[model samples]
Target: MAIKHILKLLLQQKGISLLIILQVAITVMIVSNTAFISYATLQNWLIPSKLEENQILNVTTRVFDNNIDIASLIEQDVQAIEAVPGVIAASYASHELVLDSQGPGWTMFKDTQPETDYRVFGYFGLDEKGIDVLGLKVIAGRRFYPSEYIKGSFQSNNAGVIMISEELSEALFGNGSALGQTVYISRQRIPHRVVGVYQGKMLGESATYSQQQYHSGIVPEVLWGNRQKLNYLVRVAEGVPERVLQQVETALYHTPGRMVQRVEYAARAKKRLWDGRSTFAFTMSGISLIACIVTAMGIIALVSFSVSLRKKDHGVLRALGASRSMVMTTLIKENTILVFIGLVLGFPLAILLYYFLMNNVHVQSVVELPLLVAVALFTWLISTLAVYLPAREAAKVSPAQVTKSS
Candidate 1:
């Protein structure tokens, strides 16, 4: 009987009730999507680079003059960098260090012929010391032998040996061992032998959202060319990356034909690459918090307005043998029904919004049922609390007050 009365009261205030329902629906949609985005951002930011980030340094240099002996200059720079007090190992890096904004060169790799099954991978070129300089662990097989090292241009196919990450090994060879297997690079007719498989991460903007984040390969080649930028990876001893970074430019600046572009710790470069994601996570979190608070405030305002207008009705019920608790319970039940209806409408909107994000915005996380249920329960709780104070105030109205007002 009490619920029927509350339903009739709600029908009488259709305008205010509909407004509150719309507010709840919009809030649910925005909050749910923002929460998922924030979660995905944080997950991407936490992916490990699998390199000795703090103990390594990234140095970039460019040779503008075509007459300069690029190969000899690279060799000289590596030797000078290794002579630094804190330096452990240094190598000529054909590509920029991992986790940088610059994308690595990608190519197809296949284990067997008719080329039906193949996986795309990001490729990097480093010498025999590349594995140790980047702190990669050779889980299976062995590192490149000294004889395998060669000096070549970026586009040259002089490299005959390759090392792959564990992730790539699993992708290419499945459960079988990839050691000593001949794999073809790109469309080249030449087959390069896989010498080793290491565990490491070589992340870039293109691979950030894909399973290929760790699908990378390293070649035993010291790449240098006329009028091309040269990169080097330097590994320093513990507690001296900063000190080594300071001396790297001076060590590499032996002549004026080349320009030392920049020298920085690998850890700092990785952080710089991920700073955008971090900011995005924080921004979305703040928006979610504000949306929840605003929804709560909206519920409170609408429910309070309804109670004020129904005060005389509450007073009359109290006069006709209804207790204070009964009056409060009736008002609470009315708002509870409104909240339920709003949630029923809000759920569909939330799902539609999630799909829109997945398609257009490339949202990485899935729409979990538990998270949706939690949001619904949270909305219900907030609405119930918002109505509590207003219900209590209405329950205090006296029969004499209604009679006098009438």
Candidate 2:
């Protein structure tokens, strides 16, 4: 009977009921996207790529309109940077973090003769210790040695000189061991050997399990564009202040080279992904806020009209000895019940939106539970705030005017 009474009251105020439903639905959707973003960021941080947090920094020296001996300039710059007081190691690579990801390439392997391609495959032309300074641990065989840079030594040294991410290796060679598999990148015809397999992330950009994306392939001793590569990375020593990294930039300035620029993680990687995600959240939250406010106002307008139209009914109830508190309770309880129902429906709706984004977009990235909970809680809090004012207005009826009026 109470349920029927509530439904009849709600039906009489269709606009207010619809406003409550819209507010709940829109808030739930916005919160779900926020949850997915939080999960992706936390997942990226957890990767065990041993970053040389104590004694490294990344630098990129570009050869603008002119062509020059960038390799020698890089060597000199690295030498100078290493001379800084706190610096321990220095190396350069053609890739740093996930900024410029190399696309995928593949060949049938056994049937191909000289594996030279018309294009580049994966990350090529890393300096000595590019992997190590990034703190990659070789799970098998040996790391690349400096002597292998020579032409004759290239073929001889390549017989035992390649390492790869274990995940990439497994993808390429399947369940069998990848230690000796002669995977060929169609770069230079020289078949560089895969001497070692390494675990932990490569210095820059992580390649996910995409059959379409290429693994990091070796840049053989003979390649055309190897001369102009500008990829670099640095690991800061633990507790090193921001200005400490300035030493590396200053050190490079002393060396005769093209202009090298320090890559800021915040401006680069975090902006590329996290910042955009945050912006997306901010823009949506603003829109949701507007929608919520408009809906709450609509509810208030409709409830006010309902109270005015029912003045005589309120007067009779007051005449029958109903207290103002009892009349206010009946009115406020009607909207509160609707709000509760909306949230009940919205909880599952929010979960569904979160699932759609996580599975459809970042599904490959991974979904986190804690982030979802926090976001949902935040959404609920905001919804409560939106509904509170409208509920309060309904509670503040002027009983004297209603009871005394016809």
Candidate 3:
């Protein structure tokens, strides 16, 4: 048959064509939503940190590392680690070095800007030695003056000075020198001057781009070393043996009254964030599957109904000597064309839902092309499965049984 004949037949059988198209459209919608949500979860699991892996081990002390008098003890412990052979950089950080709530950062406004809903900058109390250990780079302005380290006067020095990452600068002030401008920091109406801006050392990169999308486009982890903070981390030298790690662990074990029983990092980045995300993704997948199944069932029923209505026409074609294979192939070609038409219409809408709309709500990561291809293939598969049974039944029609006697 020519193109006109096929199109004319499709136009005549509008009800069946429309039913298949609608089912495909629903399948595409559900698949795109599921993909967008899945990727969003993956992005949050791996947050970025600048800590040098391979060389780093985070050590905790049950002792009063946070005690005021224990500040001297904490500094002494770090100095002792400095004496250890092959120990390159050892630093003490308050809560800043760890992730999630252990090192939370915020951006408080000078005068709260309702339009700009921002959090405050994270605080770090780094001694000169600890500063270099963290390896933070200055993009603009200078490091903290020594006078700022004095226990009492230190608060005065810190009251006005603030240091932050380049990402944060762009998030708050568009573009320009972030220096010299005083930014507000929460309920206190207190202002901290933007003394410097810096970039974080690339950390946790291995977690981001694995076979899974974990750490891509995550927020930079802020590193602040406070002497009073017990949550200290150390980066050992290369070629160092397990004996060295044992010695460090031994040092903690033999430290006077308190004991250091455990030291470990979470295998994955942020557990709670990704855990909730995974649950959400699984739920969406279930919903998507159900929607696709419902659509497939509807398409099959509608197509079967249409095939029954047009049974007499197929009988006429069979009387004209069209072989069973030829008749079956024609039906397959017709339905496949309807599917293609549905795809052309459904795909663009799926893309819009997955990208522009879904990412904004999820705040995870933006969905990309690979996800798009997955959704399209899934939608096509469901639609294809729906027409299979109808196609097989159409192929089994008999001409002589329907013909009238002359």
Clashes of each: 0, 17, 11
Instruction: State model 2's lDDT.
Output: 0.54
Superposed model 3: Cα runs more than 4 Å off: 1-26, 40-51, 60-85, 96-98, 101-105, 108-113, 116-127, 150-158, 170-175, 186-190, 202-229, 242-247, 254-313, 320-370, 404-406
Best by TM-score: 1
- Candidate 3 lDDT, 58-131, residue by residue in tens: 56665543334555666677877666776787766543233423223333563555664554344454555555
Best by lDDT: 1
Candidate 2 per-residue lDDT over residues 1-406, each given as its tens digit: 2667878978877876776766666665555555555455545545433434434555666555345555566667667766766555666655545444432332223214553322222444455655655666677777677766433212344433456666566666677776666655443343445677766343323242221233444432322144444656665556667675677667665444356565453234423534555555566557666755665565566666776676666666666676666676666667667666666777678677767865676432333566556655664455555445544554454557564563
What is the RMSD of candidate 1?
4.2
Model 1 per-residue lDDT tens digits across residues 126-184: 77787778888889998888887777655555568888889889988899999999887
Task: Please report the TM-score between candidate 2 and the true structure.
Answer: 0.66
- By TM-score, how accurate is candidate 3? 0.65
Higher-ranked by lDDT: 1 or 3: 1
Q: Residue 370 CA error for candidate 2 (Å)? A: 6.1
Error of 1 at 244 (Å): 2.0
- Cα deviation of 265 in candidate 2 (Å)? 8.2
**How high is each candidate's TM-score?**
0.79, 0.66, 0.65
lDDT of each: 0.76, 0.54, 0.61
Whole-model alpha-carbon lDDT for candidate 1: 0.76
Decreasing TM-score order of the candidates: 1, 2, 3
Model 1: how far is 4 from its true place, Å? 5.5
